[model samples]
Target: MNVSPPPPVGRCLDMCPMRECKEREQQGRLFRFETLVGEGNWARGRCKMRSLPLADPSKTVKEYSRPAAGKKLSSPCDLRPPSVLLKTVNYLLMEVWDHVNERDLASLAEAYIFVFDRLRAVRQDLTVQRIQGRLGAFVLEGSLGFLLCAPYLVRDLPSDSYDEVLHAKQVRDCFADLMECYGMDPKCPREAEFQALLLLYDLGNMDTINRALKLPRGVGDSPQVQIALAVNRAYLEGNWVRLFRLVHQLDCLQACSFYRHLPNARDNALRVLTHAYSSRNCRFPLDLLVVLLAIDTTGMASEMCRRRGLAVISGEKQSVVFFKASFKDSGPECAGREYILIETKRGDFTWAEIMMGENEGEFMRPKTN
Candidate 1:
């Protein structure tokens, strides 16, 4: 009969720290490779639980705004016991996955928010810690969901459309919940990814990112870490080309949604760059601006500037000038001059207040591109 060699003596025996404990160590002449058990023989004792599966993260945040099957989500987890809320959430998440895959962000938000609202609506003096844990996870899911939905939020919608404003508020509410729950005591597996996404969203806020990631300034060398850092480096150094490339090429890193938001992101960045120029000298080379905006023509740049109330002065050599702030000139053309200063708030809302609901006041706003 063929015999397989005894799985080579466990290499961990020498490195095992448990050998020092007399009570915990195996009762043998010399600490054997595999004789210890229980609290004493930690090194020799095999892992009790099965190995976890690999992290194949799915659904871009925007993708989760929709629910699966277009069918109303019926949280099957709402069984007799209140503890079954966890199961209900898991079921809703499954529905969330189905919706995101369908590219229906609206339905996705509704289902998750529905579940979250129900949990919050509960009036009992809840003693179960499991419910709290589920709430945290749900909040995380909603927060990430809005981060991806941010691009859509940035676009201008009809003010009269109640549906548009409602969606925006829903996105804001989720974002608020996310911020409130972000720095809690218990860490979740997806927290790292959420932090990475937040870094990508607010490229201008390096200090916040540094504190959040706990990394030395300008020192993200680990390839195993999320790719948001890579994008972060590019954006900070004004490497727009590389930043765009990284956005499109990181599906495996769970940033495929970044690619979807690329156009809006570029628009937002260009708008910021234009906004940064002093009112006195707003002129910039049209060709250079085109290259920086990653657009094909100066006409497009001029059109965008006009929409934002910036005067695009054309020069003989295809040079264009952008006015960062609208000048208060009394003329038929400059009638709406002051309103031009009402730049988008870019999703301004207090997280503490969001958690407080109406008690937080009515100044809630959604995040912009």
Candidate 2:
């Protein structure tokens, strides 16, 4: 019996740079792989080889590998079988998020990053393999959607260092892929919720508005979509009162989507209120400010006023004295703080409820007084 040579060792399998060269070669862009070590294992040991274009063999280009000195290797999760990847995703969503609240801020931040990376890797794998059907939908809709909404739900997580815009774009891209491959039903309430989220992300963009209009008939009429459109109108009209009222009507995930726009809304509302309530003799009640601005607390509302060049009157009736001349238009002061309405609404639903879109009727409607 002849023994075959041991399979070449120390080669990068997943995310190999030479994979691109092989693909190019298949497309008629011929390249020759040159081995730099013993046995000339050009086929498998890409880390020890370089590729040269056959048309210009004298001009060689080095194909960097994952195992190159000082380079970090790809995550082990990248090489996991599809079944294992699915189980890992399920574990993170079912086991981890259910008890995420118990972790301290430091641990929460670390956990968030770890979970995000794992989910991202899984998504990439599923996408690259063109996986479709039930498995793809589960990962895309449940795991991926949770990732999009998480930044808002989990507060103060040292996110300042990340590229938020790039992150949003990546999530949007994955969602688009999901819609294209799995086909979202207009009748599905979850679809409507996601459509509403996409619209809310950029309310002022006409392109976004047109996209919402183009959705199948009932989608635009869904409670979530209707609320999002109303919020858009309120935002454009600078009607802060109506805006916050509509915001209160949104479910937890929708509210999380709307969180990014809060600072601008608050700033604009304060400017208008300062002028409307401008008086040396009269003061605006902090309690009313809480309602009008949808702020979580009287203390936070008072602090916001103080930061904006208004005076907080401390007495039996806490009030803010806003002089139009004294009020400064310093841009949005509180960007990431939580609101009372959102917090209360958040408790009304669980992680699974939001992910799976269960209890549709209850989650869709705001709690009635």
Cα error of candidate 2 at position 86, Å? 5.4
Model 1 alpha-carbon drift over 4 Å, by segment = 1-139, 150-188, 215-226, 233-245, 250-302, 305-369
- Which tens-of-lDDT digit does each residue in 53-166 have in candidate 1? 111112111112133487432222211133333333333333333233223444434443443333332211112122234355444453344335432432332333224445
Error (Å) of candidate 1 at residue 118 is 5.5
Off by over 4 Å in 2: 1-88, 101-103, 131-136, 159-163, 181-189, 336-339, 348-353, 359-369
Per-structure clash totals for the candidates? 12, 0
- Looking at model 2, report the run of 10 residues with the lowest lDDT sum: 55-64
lDDT for model 2: 0.64
Error of 2 at 219 (Å): 1.4
Please give the lDDT score at residue 27 for candidate 2.
Answer: 48
